[model samples]
Each structure stands twice: as structure tokens, then as C-alpha cells.
Target: MRESSSSFPPHNNTSNAIHKFWNTIKCCSSSSTSASFLFISLFICTLFFTQWSHYIYFPHSTSTTNSLQFSNWTTLSNNNISHDYPKKDGYVLNCSSSKALTITCPPNYPPSNRNHKNFPSNQTCPDYFRWIHEDLKPWKKEGITREMVESLKEKAHFRLVIVNGTAYVKEYMKAYQTRDVFTYWGVLQVLKLYPGALPDLDLVFQCHDKPSIMKKQYRGWRAFVFGSRDPPPQFHYCGGDSTFDIVFPDWSFWGWPEVNVKPWVPLEKDLAEGNTMKNWTSREPFAFWKGNLRNGPRPKLAKCNSVNKWNAQIIDQDWIKESREGFKDSDLSKQCVHRYKIYMEGNAWSVSEKYILACDSMSLLIDPKYYDFFTRSLVPMKHYWPVNTMRLCKSINFAINWGNNNTKKAQEIGKEGSKYIFEQIKIENVYDYMFHVLNEYAKLLKYKPTIPEGAVELCSDRFACSPMGLETTYKIETMVNGPSEQGPCELPPSYEPLTLKSIHDQNAKIKEQVLAWEKENYGWSWWTWW
Candidate 1:
């Protein structure tokens, strides 16, 4: 209006400028929409990238991690291989579980019942030579029975797999040669009992005492069995564990091989063939115990002889060769001469329990705090008498008095214990138990049996190879000649019961502390609150 343009009217110029301003605003709004779209696209791409990275980094697994420390081991199966087969990983393992590991006993064998009181009163030994000779057909042909294959159809199928890792075989050979005669024969007897089954890739047999505590070092494929049983402390294995899962009771616990060459023999024959002559009435009316007093409560029990009477005779017996007059010191066969026999714990579980019970004498058990594979199954007062160790001497005396007063009842208890042992704990039963355990352990393997690195080969057949190497032979000779000695045990100063005064004193101290604390807090209550 102040300066008019010549080209067009002033109103026309104003209209054009307004149109330009409106277009500029529309362009700005479109730019803002594009910016929001860009941000949203970037966020989605980042989220996908993060998710993909997480998926790639984490491990996908379904098996329980607690069973073993390491996992993701691969298992490969070979269908064509037969018995004496080498592990797929190239390690040589002997008879392993052909199937999955199970807790039940083998075919036709009955699971032991602890509560069953009525057992066979007169079970006798089978023909031992015939049993082995017909079955194993070992190189020693003297015992061989020329029985046809049809004869073995009734028995369970068994395989003898000897896992021979260089180091493991060396360790096994060492134990086999150095262990007691019972251990040596007992281990070999398993092989002797069963005909060799074709070795399956899934099976493996490890030769070592695989204590539960050593599970950390164990690989999942290996199974361990031994001549002794010590269940893990406060831990029970229902089916399988980290190390070896199956623990059959030691065969030596039933009978020792040095005592009898035959693999299968009755408990009566194993202990003393003449034991039947000395029944409860014919035996002396006294409690008898003869064992080493080096460890456990043996020394205390020996000291209790001070409280002895005509009814009990507990003597300290150092069982070493030097302590004995000849090859026979206390003839074990003569042990049944006494009406009552005592059961005591030694370094671990004693091997004498079965032999003692087989004597048909009332076993005055020293209230065992530890148990082997089957000891806990025996009922107290039914199979044997329990003696509380708090007043050890008094308990023993009381048990003996009860036995003397109740002769018929005591004899019944003795016979019942003998019956239980005979029915449940034969060598045949031992082999059956082993077969089940091995079968169960095979199923738990994470991989097919493989030879460990640096391990040596062990022959599956005992007859094919020598029992010991030159070095081991030398070592055994040295051990035989060496002085027999036992390491000292950490024994308590006294086995006497705690007095009532001690208990009262502990309670009084607790009461005094409480009273003092109350007095101190209550004394300054008002001032402290302020």
C-alpha cells in the first residue's frame, strides 16, 4: 500500500507469498514423519540383532546337569560287534551292562527280605567242582565237567568284559595280586561263574574301588565294583550316581577263596564242615570273641574282661602271623564251641560277620554304627542281640545273662540268623547281584566304552594272560616278607557314658548366660530408650 508495484496488483503478490508459506509448512510436517519412521526401523533392527546373538551364544540341552560336571558328550553305537569288543572310543572294557541299568536282582533271583523270619533250616552246599567245571571250562581241566551247551540254558546270560586301560589294568593287576586271598579269588570268581557274553559297545567294566566321593573324577561310561561296600555319607544312590552306580556286596564277605578252591560252596562248608556237631545245647554256655584289639572298641571290649564271669570270655587276638603259634592259632572252626559269639567292628566292615553267624550261635552284636551292603537288613533281637556301647560291659553282661536264662529263645535266634544268611548270601546270589548291577550301570553311560589315553590293554580272559607283571610279582614277594603292621587309629580317651552332672552343667551355663544378658539390657532400659 505504501509503494505499489507496476507488474501486477498488490493483492496478487500477497496471495502468491501466502501460497509459498503454506507449502513450506507441509514439507516440514512430511520431514518429521520420515524422521520418526527412521527411528522405529533402527530400533527394530537392533532388537533382532540382539535376539539372534543370544540364541547363538547359549547351549541347548535336555539332560540333567547335576548328574555329572561335564556334559554334551556324544554316544555312538556299533551294532555288529560282539563280546570282547573294544570300546568305540578305542578303549578296551570288558562285560558291561548290555541293557539299561536296573535296581532289581537278576532273572529268577529273589530280592532279599529283611523281615522274612522263616528260611531254609538245612541248606547244604551244591557240587562245587561240578558247578565250575561245567560252566567255565578253564584251562585247568581237572575240574571241568563235559556238559553240553543245553545244560546252561536255564541260567542268566553273562559276559566277562575286562576293561584294560594301560593304567587301569596296571592298577587292577596290582590289587588282584596284592589283596588278600579272599579278594583275589572273589574277583576272579565272577568271571568263573558266567559264560562270556558277546561284548557290546554300550557296556564297560572298570577295575577299581570307586568310592562315591571320587565321583568328580569319574567319566560317565565307566562302572566300578569291589570287594568292600561303603555307601556315601548322608547320600544314597537309588539307581545311578556320578562315579560307578552299582555296588554289589563283596564276594569275600560270604566266603574266602583261599579257604576253598571251589567257586560255589555253602556257608556251613565255608566256615567249618564240622560246625553242625556243635549245636546251641552242645556248645559251652558262654560268649566268645577273638579278634585284634588294635582299632575301634576292641580294646574297650578286651578291658571289659575285668567284668567277666563264667558266662563270657572275650580275649585280645593279634591275628598276625607272629602272634600265632603256627599256621593255626585260634582255629576258626573251633569258634562254634561257645554258645554265644560276639561281633565287633574293625578298621572298616569286618569279613567275619557271615562266618560268625553261620556258626548257629546267638551273635551278640556290638550295636554297629556302620553297615555294609546287607548288615543293616538283619533285624535286631530277631536275628541277633544288640549291645548298647554306652555301658558296654554292662550291656554285654546283660545280653549274656538273657541268653543263659532264655536258652530255647536264644537258640531259635541263632538258627534264624544262620537261616537268613544261608538263604540270602550264597556265592550264586553274589554273582546274580553283580550281573544286575553291571547291567544297570551300562544304561547310564553317556558314550560307548572307549579306552582312555595312555591306558594299556588288558586281556578279557584270565587264562590267556599272566596274573601279574614282573614288577608286580616283585612287589608281592616283598609284601609277603614284610613285617605286618597297622597304622594307629584316632581313638577317644574314654568310651564311658556322659554323667548326668555334665548335662546339667551345660544347661546351667546356658541359663546363666541368658540371665546375665537380660540383666545387662534391662538394667539400662530407660536410659537407652531415651
Candidate 2:
């Protein structure tokens, strides 16, 4: 009975143990499922936190990403947010209105029309380019004065600023503070200085030949004036001498016989003799001339130590001959010298020519005319002039004080002074003389003319001239007329008109290419910065 009882107890124990093991397995499975759910929820929360941090730190990046995604959608139908949907960080939302996003037209758009409105409308008048006085004010700072303005107004025309040489107007205009200043033949300075005292001038016109616009504009005025010996073609239309109330030929001692009065009067003498001598000195006839004339025999060679005398006649001729022979015949030494030097012509021509040549160093002398002629070169030397001429010439190396030209005594003094200059001045030391001359010229600008009691009448409006009409009339005749045996003068062909269809066709092709670029680059958004 004990054995049977023990066996039954063992069986009951085994059954109970099996039941506990099954219960343990069920509990383990339940714990594992709960842990898996918690881990997944934590991972989702961490991802959302990371995305929110990126949105807060970099709003532009997040907004750009959202815009790209939105643009990909075919239809804008979804309205509500869902839990499964990718959440948009609130900080990354765009707050700008639709109107703000749209491009607004710039105030300065359609630049062509804006420029047209601002530009002067009347092109006929002298003041057309400058409808208001403000436009002319900038020129005033350069040297133009109120008196000049008034003179231009009284003249009722634009002023003439003739440039006889290859001078850059922009450079000269900047150096002086007056628009009245011109770069014409330096001899013209004498004539310009006379009428320069007058005001009422507007623009300063310059050209190789006078334009037709000058004549048309001059008709509206009372008279015209000119300093040049060459008269405008419209002089006949205006009644020749009567057409021009005043004529001041830009004459000097060293100018062409036609342009300048004779005697090559010294500057000091002209100053002392006053306006009577300055204005009334009529040109001497070639028949009665006592001094050297071009038609007369060439000057003889005399003894001189100046190297310019020898070099001018020999070296210069050789160099010129070589230059004519072309590059093959040119000696290396001579070529090097020429490259460093320039040829200067000084005589009875324009002083502007001297200024132009003197702009560079190493200028050689072609001839010797007057002492003032030497003043124009910044590096003048005796080597510039012909040997024979310089040796025989007394005027080549002297400074004449013409203010005391009482008699032949003054002439003797000039001769002695010239000899002294030749003896003392060396080619290497010529720069000193150049500096002295430049300084004196610069100092002359400070000098104001002390207008004598009767001088005011000389610069009156009666003598003032119109630049536009003077130019226009000249252009009509000179340009339209064909070339003569004297020279070639012709007008350019007329301009052709453009058609609307051609312009439209060109514009269409341009627009197509522009549109193609825009489509590839997301339209006009690229120009947002501009």
C-alpha cells in the first residue's frame, strides 16, 4: 500500500511541475511583447525630436525641402494632417503672403523711357542739351566765369573751342577750370584772349572744318566773329566783312604771312605799345618787307659752337633720309635715337604744334624761327636747329626783352643776349630753360587784363559770334561740294531707316532663347537678389 501511495504522489508532483513550466512560458512571452512596443515608441519620439531640432536651427533648409516636395505633387487636394504623414515642423512654415512672393516691378524699370524724359527735348537751341543751368555748372568750376556765361547769352550762341593740334580736349579741359579755354592753334590764343573777356558764351565747339549748324544758328544772331584767317564759307551769305563784326586773326611774329601782321614784334613791345599797336598793326606787303622773307634767298651759315647748328644740318638730314629708305636702310643706332627723340617744327605756324611735339622728350629741331619758339619745347636744345642756320642766326639762342625796343640799341642788346645764351647754355642743361619757360607760362594765367576805359566796348555783344550757324553754313558748302584741285572734301552718306518687322523678328528669337533658359533654371526666381 505504501509503494502505491508514493507512485501516485510522484505523478501528482510531475503534473503540477509541468503546469508551472507552461505558466512561466506564457508570462515570458507577454513581457517580451510589451518591451518591443515600448522600444518602437521611443525610437519614433527620438526621430521626431531630431527633425524638430533641424527645423528650428535651419528654417531656410527645411522650407526649401518642403517647397521641393510640394512642387512634386500633381494635385493640391489633401487638406488635413494625419498621424502617419511626415509632420512639418511649425518653425519651418512660410509666413509670406502670395503678393509678397510675386515679383513687384522696380521703380527704375523701362530705363529707355526714363532716360528719354530726363534728356533735353529741344535739340535746336544751344541750351537744348542742358535744359537747366545745372548742366552747365560743372564747366564753370573749370574756369568759365559768370562774365563768360553772360557773354554767351548776349552772343546768343555756342562758343568755339578750336583745337589745331592733336591735343586731348579732355585733358586740357580738366587742367583748367574754365570752359572758355580752347586748344586751338596756339597763335589763336592772341585773338581768343581779346574776346575771351566777354561773357554769354555757352558751348565750345571744335572740328577740323566748321559745321553747317554754325551758319544756321548765326542767322538768328546779329553778327559773327572769327579769330582764324580762314573765313567760314558762309561769310559770303552774311555779307563778307560786314557779316563778321570783328575779325581778330590769330597772328604772331612767327605765324604765316596771311595770318599774322608783320615785324614779328616782341611781346614786351606789344605790351608797352598798348591795344593800338596790338590791334591796328596791319600786315606788311611782301614787296615792302625789309626783313627775311620766304621768297628771299636762304640765310647763310655763320660760325657757332652750338652742337644743334651742326647736328640740325647734318644728323637730321641723314636721319630723315634713312627714315625715307624704310626699315631695312635704318641704322640700329639711328633707329634707337629716333625712337627716343621727336622732330619739332618751329617757325611761322601754330604754337599748338610745338606743344604737341614737346609732350615727349628727345625732340629734334627742324628749323629756328623765334626765341619764343624755343620756349614751347620741354627739352629744347641747340642740337634741334640746322647747323648753318643756327651758326649764322643771332635769334636762335637769345631771350629778347622787347619791352624796351626804343631803337637799334635794343636790337644790339638782343644780339648780345643771344650770344651770351649760346655761350652759357649747354644741351645737357637745356631742361633748366624749359622749366623756366613753363613756369612763366603757368604764371601768366594769374594775370587779369586791366581793361582800359575804352576796352569794354571792344568786347561788346556787337562783336560776339554764333558757333553753330558758323559751323553749319560751312559744312553745307564744304562737305556737300566735291573735292577740288586744292583738296578732298565730301559729305558722308545719309542714314537708312529700320523697319518694325525686322526689329520684331530679332526680338522674337532673343525671347525664345531667354524663355528656354528660364524654364531650365526655374524661371525668374534667380533674379530675386537683383
Candidate 3:
């Protein structure tokens, strides 16, 4: 050390220290081994220092870009992030050590506001839409034209009552069984629509057993009745020309909710949209009809089906047997799979018009003698392809043949029909019509009503009268207007009436057979009594 200090002629101390460190490394390992290790260590140190220097100098870009590469790490940076979060498939993954419950709601569902108060506050009956008597059904343009509401206002009185006592109820029931009365459904419909009307009047509903109206007065007939049924020309025995003031549709076109029956067709919402048949050519080419063969021309209609050009399926539905085997109701919505659909009358006016027309399939409608509240508006070959009763089978064949050939026009007709019905005849709209009719009738009351003996008091709040199930089959005693005879009404020429002689003859035979059966079982006295 003393010799170095004299010989080193005042060199800097820092440089001397570095030179000594280098020489120490060389001496520890052989030259090749030491040099290779030393180069790797120095290169690693250089890379690390360079990266650290970039992070510090370009802090925002370098740090954020690298840190965000891990999604979990980024999520951890969020303050309110849930540990047990829902996955993309709607299931929650529990990430917590302690047990905690997590519920995932459907996408876009609003937070529950179940307890919030309604904006309008109290809702009342008067606040809803209603149909009027003057707004006639489309098919009855010429028929039922007399303004019933105005007529009632000029010459009617309101009487509502409940008939109690087992004897009186039984007496009315006897009348109903004998077909001397026929307004059960109509009366019930009115009550449901207007429970507050004539709350205290006592009256009964009566009509001829069959759909008949004649000049002959009814025997044992009360001066006042709640209502009567059947239209002119067809039902000559109705005898409602003068005595009955109220005339409601035989049964509502829509279903009764308490009864649990839905509309004749599938609900509009459940059905596929109009013109949904993408390839109409692939559908069953022939027309189709499936229903009970009990009414005017259905039996003859069954004879009309053919394998030739007028292709169709005409089945005679046995509803009774079908019920016994547990009703296997057809999927009405699937019926549109057929290219053509047929519409025919049942016993009287069926609620099927709306259903048949609503299907996207072209409707081959048979000429109907009777019209309901809404059929007048549709034009032939427009809403439906009309089939004549005069040449029953021929007309059906021709219509279907024409439809098959002119497919584009036929599809247009189907689409139009479905659109028209869906817009006009909803269940809610049907109730609106009931409300208006009842409201108008109430305005014509001659006397303020009071609850009668053995009668349950009803306001608009009640759905039906007391003895609900039992009374469905019995005569309901209520109030009515004093009887006054009106002359018979004449039907329009466009009815295209069918000769019901065969049907009448058949009914006569059945009546004769019934009388004979009674005579054999209970003697001549029972026959005479019946």
C-alpha cells in the first residue's frame, strides 16, 4: 500500500475504488465464466431501471395502460363493487367467505312501486268507455233499426226485484223447463252489467220455448217481464211484439268471466299477427270446417265436402261425448294453418263469427239468416267469401275454387277481416257496450227501486245475485214494466232465409215422442199436465 501511494502519482480516489472492484470480480472466477455472468446481471439491471424510469416520467400513460390489463384488479379499484356479483348468464357468483343472499332480477325490470298511490285517486264506473244502442252491429244495418233507448225513455218504467220463497222460484223453474220462458242468460247478462239498476223491483223473464213470435197471446203470461229473446221472421212464437220492453242479445258475444269460458276463439294477444302465413301455398289447399251438425244447414254442409276441386273437411262435432272423455278442445290458434276456413251458424247466432274472421285463413262464410250486434259492416268477397244456401254445395265449391286460384286477393280478404275484428270486437269493448245499454235503460226508470223480500241487496260492487250456482238453472224473479202488446216485426229481404221445414218437422216428432214417453210412465194425467 505504501509503495502504491508513492507510485500512483495523485490519481482520483473514486476511480481507484471502481478499478479495484472490477479486478476483484475477474480474480473470483475464470475470465469466460465471470464475464458471461457479469454481462447478464448488468443487462437485467438496465432493463428494470429503464422500465421504472419510463413509469415515473410518463406516469399517466404507462401506469394506467399496464394496470388495466387485469379486469379483476380494475374492479377492485371501484369502491362499491359487489363481491358476489351476477354473471352474464344471470346467476350470481358468491365470492365472500361469510354467507350472504343475493337476488338477481330480470333485465330492464323497474324497481317495485307496489305501494305507490294511484294518480287519479278514486276510480268509478262512469270513467270508462261505453257502446251505444245507435251504434248498431255491422250486420244489422237495416234490422233492429228502431232506437230502443229512445223508445224506452218515452214509454217505459224500471222495476227490479228479487223473488224469494221456494214455491215461487219453483213455479218459474217449471215455466223455464216447459220452454214457456227463455231469457235466463239475457237477464243474468243485464244484472251483471247493471247491478245498481232497479235494486228493489220484482219481475220475471219469460219467452216462448222456441224461437217464435206470433199474434197469439201467451197463456199464464204476467203483464210485465224483464225481457224476451229471438228476432223477427225466424222465431214466430216470441209474442214479444207488445208485452216485453227489454230485448238484450240472446247471449253476449264475449264470454262470461265468472263462468270461466273464454271467447270462442283464442285471445287476440295469444294469436299470431295478421298475414303471418309466410308460404300460403304450402298450407292445406282445401277449405275446412269442424262443428256440431245440429242447426239449419250444417247437415247439408256435411254433404258438400269433396275430394275433387272443392276440397274441404266437414266434421260433425259431438260436444257431449267430447265432454265425457274430458274435453279435448282444439288448439284454435293452430287452425290458421289451413288456407281456407269456413263459418256456419250453430243453433242460432254463434259467437264463432269473430273467431272465424280473426283467423288469417280466408273465410268461406255460409249465408246466415240471423245477424248479431256486429256483422252488418262486412261486405261480401271483402271480409269473407260468401256461400249461398240456395246452391249450398255449389257455392262453397265455387268460393274455394275461386280463392285457390286468386290466392293473393283471398289472403288480402283474410288479413282485412282479422284486422277489422281485432280492432272492433275486443272483450273490453263488449263490456263497454253492455254498460252503455244499461245506463241508458236506467235513465228511463218510472219508479225508484227498493230491495224486495228474500232478496239480497246489490250495488255495482257485487258480481252476481245470491244463490249464484243454484240460480244459474232457475228463473230469476226481478221487476219489470207492465205488459203492452207490440205488433210483429218484419225481417229484411237480404236474410237469404233457409227453409226450416225439416228442422221443424224433426222437433215436432221429438215433442210427440216425449209426450208418448210421459203418457206411458205417468199415465194420461201427467201427459195432459205437461
In candidate 1, what are the lDDT values of residues 355-399, reduced to their tens digit?
A: 778778999887564444445347666788766565566566666
lDDT of 2 by residue, 401-446 (tens): 1112232442232233333323322221222222222222222222
Query: What tens digits encode model 3's per-residue C-alpha lDDT throughout 1-530?
Result: 00011111122333455566567666755656766887857865654433322111000111312121100000001122112211222112122311111122223221121211122223222211211232222213333312322222222212123322101111111221212122333343334333333122223333322232232332234213424232221211111323222333333232222122233223455455433654467788888887767675578888877747457778776654653443344445556777788898755445567777888778877766545445645656567776656546656666677678888998898878887677766543444444344344434334443342332222211111211221211212221111112211111222112423443355446435533443453355633334
Model 1, CA-based lDDT:
0.41
Superposed model 3: Cα runs more than 4 Å off: 1-266, 273-279, 450-530
Specify the highest-TM-score model's number: 1
**Between candidates 1 and 2, the TM-score winner:** 1
Better of 2 and 3 by lDDT: 3
- Taken over the whole model, the C-alpha lDDT of each candidate is 0.41, 0.23, 0.41
How far off is residue 481 in model 3, in Å?
34
Ordered from best to worst TM-score, the candidate numbers read 1, 3, 2
